[model samples]
Target: MNKTINQKAWFFVVPVFVLVAFNAVIPLMTVVNYSFQETFGNNVFMWEGTRWFKQILQSERFHAALGRQFLFTGIILVIQIPLGIAIALSMPKEGPWVSVCLVLMSMPLLIPWNVVGAMWNIFALPEIGFLGHTLNGLGFDYNFTQQIGDAWFTTILMDVWHWTSLVVLLSYAGLMSIQPAYYQAAEIDGASRWSVFRYIELPKMKKVLTIAILLRFMDSFMIYTEPFVLTGGGPGNATAFLSIDLVKMALGQFDLGPAAAMSLIYFFIVLLVCWVFYNLMMKNEEQS
Candidate 1:
């Protein structure tokens, strides 16, 4: 006997497809058009071929910004993932405090990004800001606005403060999903905490951890508003990640072609990293 598949679901999905194409595809095509052409005034555009792409690819400023962007993302992932897991591990598995802890963990994620940046900016000022005042009072020369090291430190610290909660929540959910039978079996076998985690919890949490890493990587890689509001890509271009540099090229200097090309390259880099990392993760899962 042959089975028939219903095609009526297409009627419900067409609107969503059209909406997505309008919102996503049209803008992307606009960017592609802008990337290959130059506009001086009005809506006029002249064909420039691949000159903008080559110029952006060869530019030292682009290289520096790209390096900084990667470095920031690397540092964020390194710190946030382990730290989030540790926090999740230490939390009470069953208690009234669970709700409280979850609420606290979620608070940071709820704050507006620009507000978080401004809050940190004011909070870290050396004169009246509590953090800076305390550090300076402790005999430390800490001025993020004036010093490169301090600026980078503050940027990294701010991101960790803001996004680590996402990792913690994801890890905690993974931990919560492990069956009690696994722990009982581990206990019967005299499995140490490390052994239990290694054999059971770690493996169980692999999917969530993969999700957490990918999310953090993409967010950190594309970060702009917070750091731009916080440091304004300042301390002499030290914190000027790719997003900030792209904005500078497009709006600050009115270089639309190069900016559009850079944006596409930026999009490709994110896509490539996510693709490679996700494939490697899936490959490991399949092997195990």
Candidate 2:
């Protein structure tokens, strides 16, 4: 017997394919095109080959920005992951308070990114803002605008405030999915709280924790807007992570070739890290 395949479902996918091509593929191709050539006005271009890429890879500024980006992402991950899990553990799992807790947690994630940046910008001014004023009143010497330490602190604090909720939500969902039988078993065995968490909750949460780590890594690695608005990459480029630096090169300095090269590098870095995370998570799943 010969089978004829029905291809009608592809019609539904055609629109989505075309939309992605127009929005993602086409612009990506343009960036690749610009990455190889130098332009000097009136559509004039020179085929510079790998010159831009070499410059970007060798630049000290790029290195500095990359290091800062890694540092920021690392710090936030260390803080947010455990903190989110702790808060989720503390939260009422099944009560009227659950709804109130969830809503409160969601509020930060609902705020627009740019608005969060702008809000934090004023909120950290060290003059009129409540946080700034309170800190200064307590003799903390906090001034984000002109102080590198303060700027970094403020930016990190703002990020933790805005994003910890996401991790909390994910973790709480993971915890709730776990069967109560595990807890009952632990109770019967006279398991300590830490023992329950270690042998049962943590193991069960591994998958979601992996997902949470990946999401947070991607977001923090590509973070740009909030720190930009708050510190403006100031205090001698202290908070100028890779994204901020790339914008400065592309728009601020109008160095298209180098900027494109740097952007492609940035893209590859993010892609590579995500790929590694995926592989590690998959390997762990296989082993378990």
Residue 136 of model 1 has an lDDT of 98
Clashing pairs in 2: none
Candidate 1 lDDT tens digits, 197-275: 7899888888889899989999999999999999999998999999999999999998999999999999999889989
Best by TM-score: 2
lDDT of 2 by residue, 1-288 (tens): 997899998999999999999999998998898899999758888899999999999999999999999999999999999999999999998979999999999999999998999999888779999899999999999999998889989999999999999999999999999999999999999999999999999988888899999999999999988988888898889999999999999998888999999999999998999899999899879977
Q: Candidate 2: how large is its RMSD?
A: 1.5
Candidate 1 clashing pairs? none
Report the alpha-carbon TM-score of model 1 versus the true structure. Answer: 0.94
Residue 154 lDDT in candidate 2: 95
Model 2 residue 287 CA deviation (Å) reads 5.2
lDDT of 2 at 115: 95
Separately for all candidates shown, the number of backbone clashes (residues 3 or more apart, or on different chains) is 0, 0
Instruction: Give the TM-scores of the predictions, in the order they appear.
Output: 0.94, 0.96
Whole-model lDDT values for every prediction: 0.94, 0.93
Cα displacement (Å) at residue 206, model 2: 0.6
